[model samples]
Target chain A: MIQNVTLVGAGNVAWHLGAALEDAGLVVDVVYSRNYSNAKALAERLYDAVPTDSLDFSESKSELFILMVSDNVVQQVAEEMTLPSSGAIVVHTSGAVPLEALANAGLYVGVFYPLQTFSKGKKVDFSKISICIDSKSERILDMLAEMAYKLSKKVYHLNSEERRKLHVAAVFACNFTNHMMTIAQEVMESNGMHFEMLEPLVRETVDKAFAIGPDKSQTGPAIRGDSKTIGKHLEELDGKARYQEIYKLVSESIAGIEKE
Target chain B: MIQNVTLVGAGNVAWHLGAALEDAGLVVDVVYSRNYSNAKALAERLYDAVPTDSLDFSESKSELFILMVSDNVVQQVAEEMTLPSSGAIVVHTSGAVPLEALANAGLYVGVFYPLQTFSKGKKVDFSKISICIDSKSERILDMLAEMAYKLSKKVYHLNSEERRKLHVAAVFACNFTNHMMTIAQEVMESNGMHFEMLEPLVRETVDKAFAIGPDKSQTGPAIRGDSKTIGKHLEELDGKARYQEIYKLVSESIAGIEKE
Candidate 1:
């Protein structure tokens, strides 16, 4: 029933999702962006899609409008927009934000969060990414579910509270883990080793998580109660106070797990 | 040249590495273990391989003997065994042990640290795992390099000091990251939510690391300096003092990265 869809941002998520929706035989009405070049770039990749400015959508011809803007600006963008009516489904692709922001504007609101990281140049396979959906109305929810299921194999109807909880887990699992990798890369790069050398280990760590639960799959000197190695590493860390502190904290945590 | 390789441990690393070597056309000669069943279990997987408690190996029998025992016993095992000759390669699959332990035995000594977390009941793919090799002699080093390359796509010829440094990074990247995951799972599980729900987020976190360098790829309320969300997560964590401390410490680290 999703006849026409309008995209209101031109960032990484928008670029990927627009292509996916179009590829699935959905009619993409118009794609808008404050940055004309970004919008045009995404629009050029989609069939029968036109790059347009905000003024072009004044008529609100589409049945659904997806605002793939930054999380901080989602509310502001919703407030600044004029919509067709209170019936059209409006959704934002932010993992953290609730659908209430769109509801306050008297428009049918929902969330269409694709649970994966997006990089501008990287090709994302939507089939593998999980999609989290939420909406105020059951009808809109059904529509969103259909659209989401077409793109991803896994779709969850997470309430705002549950979605927020998932978002927090996401921060720990995805964002913080990546920061740890960054620290590893920095440590190696400072010693004249390429960051690419860590890629195999990084991939293997993730692969292990999928195979065995993280708790049982955990391994290192910290778990083995080998303080000799831990002390040596702390000394090697030297002046990097943050890295040393992290090593201490994580080692202590690993030691606790072993104790339990 | 690694026609017959002897594995001197029956743990997970030894089990997986021995299997990989056999699969790669290298004949695994003998699997020696203190626990007879563990050795037999691993040896059963390889053709023409036998498990034994035999500590004595006649000189010039096997070309390479992989000491995959626990770190604490590696030195003892090296001292107790009779290696082939100075030309025979003696390698221990430990990240922390010094190569001189085997060198003191009047044979070629090296380290074959497979940079991965191995767990029983789960199969591993050696094609992607990184093997860090260290040796005192060039001939032994070349042979180890050839074997490592045959088993894995990535093999690094690092000295003992550099291998030790990389091991420290592995602790941060793999073991520490897995602990963080356990924390995330604990937080959700205690709140009457299933840990399975966090799987999508966990997968995305690792996939994101592969896409961009972890530092630049990181995104969260902490990185964005949104104290409101961080405070909310702390409140949600409640009486879990350790998780709260970790959440705070990691958030501060993310914020510090932004400041840098």
Candidate 2:
């Protein structure tokens, strides 16, 4: 059981994870951040968890420490923290960084990555999020697995390499998809059309991808090699050079998929 | 009132439109298609609607004729169908085709494009989808608008030029987004990871794009010029050479956005 937990960040992931842990009946022992106010705000919602701005190595006192800081800060934060005991486990919620970074501290370290992008001021459904866990020791891995299973139905014992691969996949799926949507919104708005018009299609595309997976569910003019429609779309570009290029590139890519 | 409607072809669009219209208390008087079973199945969904397989010009007989056939078949469907009445309104549900194709038949012609990607066996929330309407006559346009408003909250009186532009935008927002998701799924499954793991991130990326728009919300290794991680990711790519190239291209594009 994850009885007491310490959260070492106050970003979107930290806020949601802190609240989720508390809701799961775990005691969030303390919340720490360089920005004391951010720590306090998250702590206030975490069932009496104490909030502090202190980075003192002397304060490492929880059974589980969750580092929810940015990817760039994960290593520095890990280096500065002092564990209360070698028995305590330190984990960072980052997709990139190796598990070995925690080894030099001579503590039981692992990763507790929530495979989700969190936004501030929005509630997260942890049940839908996958938790990727990896630890230096079997005993620590077991404890992390137990905690992850409590929060999510899907849990994976991924090493640094696998996690890094997954992160790259996430870039393609999440980041690229969002950019595509943004381009679509820009195109619609430029035509005096409302962006909301694409909302149903957007929602459906995601739902369908989840339902049948993406391979079989894919359909469009590009996949069909309907060059007439593609040509018309390109002509409709009317001097918007970059967007037209994107349209051509993506369509050609989809066409290539069809060829295979 | 769009009391009497004639469906000129039995297909995905026709089936959906007939059902929605019947549910909204309109009369689908006749459905004509080369495939009798399809026409019959659609007509059966409507109250007392007749299904006809006639291609003869003498059989024309309805207030509104909707040709919901394929893009290539639409023009042919329109050319063969004689208007039941000289003043009867004719419309087609196509994003790319001009409303003018429904002309030359000596009837009031227009377009009634429900701006959504339709799939058989999938139930859609029509109320949220936008309907694009255009007619040769203002009275016909008003009637189309009212019918559209009955089914949805959004109704746009887009001319052929504007509707063509919207179609091009749809290719980006709907079609291209789907392709990106397909690639993401491919990358994950080709690895040891399950496609389900990427769902949360996919949903969040979309939510964030809408919240801040893509241009400002973009954040990835590429945008940050974190070439170290990018190189690591490239090294991690197992056998998906196409995906790696896509990753490189998109990353460069994101870097360009950051520079701008």
Candidate 3:
């Protein structure tokens, strides 16, 4: 079992994951960032955690090193980290990155990605989130499974390819979903209405989608193929060609028409 | 004030709205549908509502004729209804149709469009939904406002133009949102994974969007301009041109590239 961990970055993921691990009874031994203040700020959140600017963990007694850094730097940071080679486990909290990124950095390298979006200062219920863990060795994987089970109710052993697919799906489900909301807000504000008025509808739609399946919960002119209403909506778009294009293409897709 | 109502359809909106009106102390006098069975099915839910397949309302003592029919039939239903002259108010519960559609049927015509996507057997809290009411005359508008207030807290006097925009926005925020979920679901299921694992991330994404505004809630490779991740994602969608196209266009839009 991994009893202690060193957070290798001070990002939103690092902050949240670090706190959740601490709450799960694991000792967060050190927090490190290129910027010392950021490391110090996050380190201050945990009990008796030290903050460091360097990647050298030669002096610390941490059994695990968790790379909460950006995807671009996951390999770089892993390569730079001072590992003891035998007793330590190195893991990254990235969905886009593969487990092999840290292969040369430590003897036992793995992935500890939580499939959720985190923002600075915002609290997340880690207990409800899905944690996807992957590793080469069975022992390390078992250790990860045990550690993850402590922080969340849902834990799965997903490989690099599966994690990449999940990451892409997340991009659509979360990022594109938010962009759609932004479009709705722009449409409302442009027409002298407040976006807040649509909150109940938005909330209800989401609830209904999950309650029934998403494929079965679909409604509107698009799915119904009410072309007249669709035409009128497109006409209403008038000058905003961008929104009109999206509205048209998405509507077509919903109606099961592609290659047009 | 409108005390009794003649519900002009037996669809999902009519089913939910009829219940809400009765709960708000208004008498649902009649439930009508072209199919007599559908009318009876919904009518059975009310305390004393009569189910009818007839368009004539001359026999009923309903003061408000609420047309909850399909958008294409709103004007046709209004014309077919055997409305009583002068005292009776005619209104259609549609976001697309104008109040003028019911003008020839009665002296008072308006809209009582609740901005919501209702599903049968799925209960919604009416008080949280927005009711967009509009009429040409002040007295009729006030009557609709009074009736709406009893049903919901958020009431807005939106004209037909504004209501159209609101409807389009609903299409994006609700329908398009659900479609995105469907895309994510398909992605997961086809990749040897269950969509339920994504529920936590989906829920958090929505919560964040509403807590902080949607404009400020966007996070992904698209917004970050992470070309490597974007290329990897596009490559993952290989051979699925429809999804690849969407991924490209939406990513470009998020990156603020409208024309190119």
Candidate 4:
């Protein structure tokens, strides 16, 4: 059983995860960041956590170390960290980085990736989030699973490759979908239409996608092969080159899928 | 006041709209479809509705005619329909087609576009749907708005150009977003991952998009300009040429937006 955790970043993920861990009665010993003020701000919220900008974990005694840093610095931070040679499990809260990224940091290494978008000041209901975990050993896996279950109702034992694949899928589902919305908002704004008008349509679209499978739920001029409507829409987007390219490509893709 | 409605299609939209009109205590005198059985099915559910596959309205007495057909056939259907040449108002339930498409058919022409996706078996609450109405004159617009208000709480008086622009925006917000969900589901299914795992993430993504504006809520390696992670994801999509192109283009677009 992991009683205490050392949080290794103070960004969005860490801010939420640290709070969740504390809520689950887990002790957070230290909150570290490259910037001391960030670490201090997060550390003050915990029950008993020291804030520091140091890589030296010599004074910090914790069973679990969660490196919630950016993907690029995860390896560098893991390499620079000093932890006990035994009995300490080092994990990174990254969807992209594999467990091997933290292999050299501790005796037991794993991933404790929470699959949800985190934003500062926005409260995340951890119970709704899926926590994907992987470890090098069965014992470590079970330990991480137990820890994860405290924070989330959905827990999965996903290996590096499976988690990475899930991450890429997430980018399409969340990131790309959000970008499409951005473009939609831009289209509405450019035409002097209020963005709120699209809300009902947006909600219904997603509800339909989930109700019927997206492939079957697909509806539009592209799927219907209404060239006239598609042509008019293209003309509507006359000078917006980037949007035009996207519209043409995505419509072609939808048509291709419909044919299949 | 328009008390009687002649519904000129028996598809998803017509099915929902017919029921809503009847619920509002407006009489639905007829339900027409190219297929007799479809018309019969919908007509059976309404009070005193005549199911016919004919364009002849000489036998039918109704104050309003709603041509809820496909966009491509909307104009064609309107041209073929025979309605009262003076008092009866004509409208098409389409976001794309302009009012002119129905002008020559009836003395008073307009649009009664319910901006929400409808499925035959699924019940739609009209109150939540935004009904976009437009007409050639204020009197006609007011008439359409009154009828629309009986069904939906949200109603807008959009001109042809504004409605067309809204329709294009809907394509991005609804159709394109659905396509993104399709791609994400495909990726998950291809990797032996159950698509249900994405449901929470999908719901949260949309919630976040609405909570904060889509542009501000954008989160991903692409928006962060993390090329290393982007390159890694591209490597993961290796042989899927279409998906790779989409990932590249969308990521580039996101990066470009982030820079601004």
Prediction RMSDs, each to the true structure: 3.0, 3.0, 2.2, 1.4
Model 2: per-residue Cα lDDT over B6-98, one tens digit each = 888887778777888877778888888898887798888778888878865355446788888777667877888766544687788889999
Docking class of 3: medium
Per TM-score, the best of the predicted structures is 4
Separate clash counts for every candidate: 1, 2, 0, 0
Off by over 4 Å in 1: A30-58, B48-50, B58-60, B84-87, B187-208
Write candidate 2's Cα lDDT for A117-211 as tens digits: 67665577888788999986898899999998888888899998788878888887877777777677777888787777777778877887888
Write down the worst ten-residue block by lDDT for model 1 chain B: B186-195
What's the candidate order when arranged by decreasing DockQ? 4, 3, 1, 2
Write down the lDDT of every candidate, Cα atoms only.
0.80, 0.80, 0.88, 0.89
Per-model TM-score, in order, reads 0.89, 0.89, 0.95, 0.97
Predicted chain A of model 1: TM-score relative to the true chain A?
0.92
Q: Report the lDDT tens digits of candidate 4 across residue range B1-260.
A: 99988999998888899999999999999999999999999999998999999998875679899999988888899989987645688899899999898867867888999998777666788888999999878998998999889888899999999999998889988889899889888888999987778888888888887778788888999989999999999999998888888899889889988777
Query: Judged by TM-score relative to the true structure, which candidate is superior, 1 or 4?
Result: 4
lDDT for each residue of candidate 3 in B23-44, tens digit (9 for 90 to 100): 9999999999999999999999
Model 3, span A223-251: residue lDDT tens? 87799999999998889887888898888
lDDT of 4 by residue, A131-212 (tens): 9999989999999999999998899999999999999999988999999999988988888888878888888888877787
Error of 3 at B78 (Å): 0.9
Two-way lDDT contest, 1 vs 3, winner? 3
